[model samples]
Target chain A: MNELHIPTMAQMAAEGKAPEILFWVGCAGSFDERAQKITRSICKILQHVGLSYAVLGTEESCTGDPAKRAGNEFLFQMQALTNIEVLNAYAVKKIVTGCPHCFNTLKNEYPQLGGNYEVIHHTELIQQLIDEGKLKTEDNESFKGKRITYHDACYLGRGNNVYEAPRNALQVLDAELVEMKRCRSNGLCCGAGGAQMFKEAEPGKKEINIERIEDAIEAKAQIVASACPFCMTMLRDGVKIKEKEQEIQVLDIAEITARANGL
Target chain B: MIAQLVFLIILAAAVFLFSKNTGKIRRNILLGKDADRSDQPALRWKTMAKVALGQSKMGKRPVAAIMHLFIYVGFVIINIEVLEITIDGLFGSHRVFSRPLGSLYGLLIGGFEILALLVLVSCVVFLSRRNLLKLKRFQGPEMKEWPRSDANYILFIEILLMTAFLTMNAADYKLQALHFGHYIKAGSFPVSALIAPLLPSNASSLVMIERGCWWFHIIGILAFLNYLPYSKHFHILLAFPNTYYSKLSPKGQFSNMASVTNEVKAMVDPSFVPAATEPGRFGAKDATDLTWKNLMDAYTCTECGRCTSVCPANNTGKLLSPRKIMMDTRDRITEIGNNLDKQGKDFQDNKTLLDDYISREELWACTTCNACTEACPVNIDPLNIITEMRRFIVMEESQAPPSLNNMFSNVENNGAPWKYSNADRMNWAESD
Candidate 1:
């Protein structure tokens, strides 16, 4: 019953000024205050760069991804059509989102629903913000010596092959980056995403996220960073459960980008 | 000679009765599952050929495969030997054709007997590896359901076969000594030499014992043959076809949702609104719901346990066991086949054989990883069956993991499964 929604690239292109850019705010971004804040920061940056764009809010429905994956094809279709109706009404095109799950669902799965859109993750956009010299890092010399390890969300890296964007954004900041043995394509799931982030995992001897977190801790990192809200939440919870919350902080890629932009 | 004739009659009668009872056994297992004839002649023949003859994917262990091959070939070739032995018992003849040691007729019998002995030794190794030593790994639900009854039958046949060979050799040694006078040149055979001192000095009595051993050997074979269609030995006929027509393509390809028709409507239309179909029926619940090839896979498993060993879910101590699923499906299929005449009589409502076969916990434990399918030697895809069951659990019963309920509700209410307020969707972009 996980209702997913997707906005079509074709319909979005035909309407509403073809918004110089589209903001693909995912389910978590719609709900989580911090995630929403990061998304708004990126939109503000686009505006500052003289790029006009439209944010669709919750009119963007579920991506029909979780239902299809859970083998509930019927529910997936309902969510897909509902979102398609919304996009057609607004005449919206193009999208940018902070949530990797929404990004993947829109870029990869929506085409199956006849809603093909050119979707870009926010980190890819943030690097553009830095390369154009439109934004500069804040003097948070506090972050200078901190050893941060980037946890690759499976969807962004393995699922869709968006590996370097997050890392490249992290490089623009001065934090030292550590690497886990299981990184990139071989990265472990944070027991979230694929609707897994919402449901309790099939009962097993170990929590998948804890297992993933232990790998990050083994790298001796002072911070764990990610691009997806689900990974951020799961890893943050994992750090607390492992009693490493204060010792190792979890931050979104956008949070890092915003801080580097001196916001 | 008259005693031998009576023995032959009794052995033949026992075989007939055993074969007759197969239908009953087949029916009892089919309860709770749909039993119907799939109308694909080409598929049936292809499955039969691949599973029965090829056994190409039995396992990775070549030694075990070679040993099993010897037993398989011996079981087939020894049937001819059994017929020759049955005739000799009924007619008071020692040899099928009267001829000297160098003659083709004499040589033919000698070669068959040698091969039979070789197969017997190989079966001993197979038994030791499987049961006594407790070697070989297996996963999935069906592993636990292996009926010990079949093991007993296999052991009894092996014993009878070895005993008959030894006793017949002892009697032959006595006959050679009494008829050919010392027969030192004929003593080259090792088994005959060991039994020569044990055989009675009377030449006619030696021939009588030899005829008795022949009856024992032939009856043993008949008993085992009648067991074929009913027992796990069903794999002896099923594995070859499962291998030959196995999914030659990769497991990653989703069955094309775009091209599939209504009859093949495996997925919901991505373009339409969602509606309820049936309860407890999102995927396949039982055998009939499976594709034609999947049915073939159920019959073809050799119970070798190779697929079970490599399963990550099983190794990690989850309840999903792939071996048990195959065994249970075959067991269920045979039961349904036996009861085909009953016509839609609710088998599950009976609360009979199926209760002990497959469990609900075992069914839900699968992650649909395709690991078991990849590991199977004969290409039996256990994940296919597991996924089919998942469909039924969700679509028909409207039952799934409790967490999925929360997810379904979130997706229904919000555009996604997350529970945040709609107003905050773009808070990130506006934040300092």
Candidate 2:
């Protein structure tokens, strides 16, 4: 682990300085053990590019995506309004999130309730940094010619039509990008969306993630790349189910970018 | 003269029955809660044109699309000939248009014959696809008895009606050849010409066959018209109106709850005290709670299984069938309407759409992916209905799954979906 000193938005505001973007560390990034690595990877990429960023830290709350999706509209509104009040108090204008669910809620759903901000998914932010020549990647032989297939998170792909950003980020790694039969607009879900991640799956012939992983295997990719934390969890579980964990690795786009940059 | 009197009596009875059924369907659909989608008249018209008239989304499955187009176009065009039939049956006239229109009537009848053949062929293929080939989408638990039998019954009716039409034309051609009483030599029947050879050449028998077939054709058309309100075949009439009022907003944008949003606004504004109002039940627990557009969508469902075929959950062997959701909604509304008609509107059935029709497992299996909505040619949003019912379960009954219960409690105490407090949010950013 590397020591990383990250300042809070409150600290930045008190110092009469404002970070360019607020990193919304969603619940998965903040508390889930595996998703925490993805959060650190995103932080490393931001630091590597010399981007000014600050976290909401203790002041941040959930964007109420799960509650909304789970049908508790009242709870969702309460959660959304509390977060909106804190963000509005700090005059936060731009936000970047590692989770597509949070990104989607903040970008699409928050506007109606007066919580408007320029929300960008981490993969999209990374793609922007690469395009701007701020983030550089060497021809790393570690991932060179490695067959990788990018799984489109529903919220990032069909939910928002963000099909290009994550793929563009992976293009920088010099990996052979193989596409699953159901990719982009036709992508299948990882079975974790719409609050399914919080509940046991209903009885079915096969889990949705398993079916999705079969698509990855059919694509013959050794690495499955995902842009959303929920997708990463589902894909990883699928790989474990097939007992191919040793052969196949499920990783976030940020983790790949961080690894390639040797940050 | 007495024969014509009997025909008028039969026609009146059929019309009365058809109108009564139509009225009941209209009342049942209006039982749903109101949702104001009346804005954007130009957009609504364009949507109706593109979706219902143009059949734009049908192109997703090209083979089925073409087959459906043949049936759809044939159904619309052939009904014009029915208008003439209605006039003739009511006035006791024979070939009324042929006398004035002459050769144009020949061309028109010829065109109708061709369309009738096409509709016959399309219906046969559709029937084989449903019954013989047994497409997976058509055989699911949701399509159990009534749906499956209802589909075959409509196809059977169409086959009978088309047969009766061609038979009537063939028998009339024979009678005209014999120069029988009141049988004028007019209106070409190209397709039916082949069938004329199969019939007996006797004048008396030909007259009986022609009269019988004519009566059957007209009466069957009236029966089918009335049956439309009771069957999923109602899409023949409701598709236009349903598509006309389709949601113009982007699919991903969920509508905000005005009640909850106002409360949130009050929380932020210091001087704004929220009105002390009783909290109403959230989301839809039954068909009545749904919007009128949702009810229209139910009636507009063609039972085409396109939504179910493309549903990722159903494809992955999950129980969430979007087609079933719409069918269930329609069935529930009909039941409620019947209850209201039999007993007063105040009658309670002690049953609800939530448990009696749709199961919690089916509702929870949905991923809210919008694939069903995208695949629907009529723009029915099953995801919207699913979300509404889920809202009822969680908000009104507090019956969310245990895992969701954990997440809810965590959100309440920690302001997030995890058990950890916000104090630990920055821990992930800390270095070892």
Candidate 3:
């Protein structure tokens, strides 16, 4: 296993087109079409508001979290070093990844491999873009009377503390935002963390996602919004399994942002 | 003056009983040998500072950590009160303040008694949290053979202590009424004021009650001191240092493997034959397999069940209870020590007890997720023992779960746990 050594946000921001931000479409976001579409929509909004940005598709890599949690520390280190080297080569900085796992690993775990970077999750960047008047919600009235709920992804909310950005982004659209009983630091794990997303849980009493989606239903939310691509996928799956897909919608925070933008 | 002599006698008796019981506990409960000279002192002192003073292990949860800090400080402060009580019992006069800065001393003593009460109440809350409220992670793992005696002993000791405390105050209050003809100035403890109304109006009755309660209190202390080594209260003394001396390594860091190359090299040489001596065991197979510090963790378990409650493996209906792992190790150590202490060289006959103490199935069920290690307020590293057991099984017996063996072989052969070809590994990198 080779190391993934990537550049920091400060370094990347200094080089290339010196784009206002580098949107890092992680492995999950690249593979998942819905997430890809939402990211594209967010990018379209960023471009529309004249915010200079470069999408660093090549700078992306598995955050090596799955490997580390699996006790393959050497593999994770190799992946981290390799990612660092690629990012360094591209002179990429000010990273914005849609995946909380990638964002958390790049910001928190990479320092152990000697890669320090100012990595922001996509919601923070999108909300920042909106706050700066670079993105707008033209159809804010669409969610005027509709009640929505925000599901705090463990990695994004508790693992890193990106709670405010996603909620703020949704609230900016004037939607009725309700919080599930367990939100923020005490937010329940979506059972998708620690690369449990890739592996099947060994026949537990309940699927972790069902527990979380049930909480959303308890909140009486018409839609359950999440920031991480994995959370979106799990919640969507939970909605299907619980036979509530017709009554409830699972959406990525970016999709909500896109809808608000009338894109 | 007679009372002063009695107090001195009680103090001496307490010291004797406490020292005796603690010695027994060190020998039996933890099988704690006088630490080896090779033991790290600098590490121990550093650990004491961080764990005893800093509450480092309790840092995972703030409420629990802060509560522990109060208890620790309260324990230290109340020691002065214990000495004061001993002196008062020996002296004709209850002159704990009969020294320099006596008023200030009394105030400090009073403050600490109140704090001690608070700490005691909080401990009760913590206990309730484990047994009743069912805080998600505080319930200890269910043991196949929990020392049923230990639970009974713990309940008995706590009740005895609380009773002794209340009785001691009652004695003091009655004696004060007898001497002063009304009420003695209630010391710093506000609860002691309750003694004023409860005192018998008849002087002789009050005196008899005081004498009886005084003796009962002293005897309770002695019995508790003697019982310390045999019961779970052993942690009451050991928790401070054990929590501090915890492993500095990350939760994932296992006991380092023995230098394998040296042995393998000699084994491969045509003229060489390996010695029949035990192969360098990577993990613990029995009590002797544990390091002294690992043994220390056994003595330090309060049996509060905090580790078992939070364990993902246990909650998922697995056999791996982190609490029981420590208890099993502790019990096995005690059993081995008791055997060795009584039978000396003939202790090898008792090896059968080891197999029954911990099952290989329970040992293998741990996911090493660190939730147990994380939730332990005392910072007992239960995962280390699990990993150690795994290491021994894999290295010594060449035994492993079938899938794990396949995974290990795949990694050695293909540089990945999966059997996928290297071409697939490069696909993620090569793809646009």
- Candidate 2 residues lying further than 4 Å off, grouped into runs, are A1-7, A40-53, A123-146, A164-179, A256-263, B1-9, B98-106, B172-190, B262-271, B275-279, B310-319
Which segments of candidate 1 are over 4 A away from where they belong? Answer: A1-69, A76-198, A201-263, B1-54, B86-94, B97-114, B130-132, B136-146, B180-205, B241-249, B253-302, B330-357, B409-432
lDDT of 1 by residue, B107-144 (tens): 55555656666777786776676567766462233445
List DockQ, one per candidate, in order.
0.18, 0.60, 0.08
Which structure among the candidates has the greatest DockQ? Answer: 2
In terms of docking quality, model 3 is: incorrect
| Candidate 1 CAPRI category | incorrect
Error of 2 at B147 (Å): 1.6
The DockQ-based order of candidates, best leading, equals: 2, 1, 3
| TM-score of chain B taken alone, candidate 3 | 0.80
- Expressed as tens digits, the lDDT of each residue in A109-130 for candidate 3 is 6655456667888788878887
iRMSD for every model: 4.8, 1.5, 6.8
**Worst ten-residue run, lDDT, model 2 chain A?**
A1-10
Model 3 over residues B1-432: C-alpha lDDT tens digits? 676676677778778878875676565634432233235677767777766566666675678777666766766776676666666666654545536555675577467556656666666766665457766553334532345445545554544555456555655655664575434555544555565476666767766665676566556666666777776677777877776577654343333232332344354455755545444454567866766777888888877676776554465565668888888887778777777768894658546323577776666555454556656666788776766665566666666656655655554444344464433432332222
Scored by TM against the true chain B, the candidates give 0.71, 0.94, 0.80
In terms of docking quality, model 2 is: medium
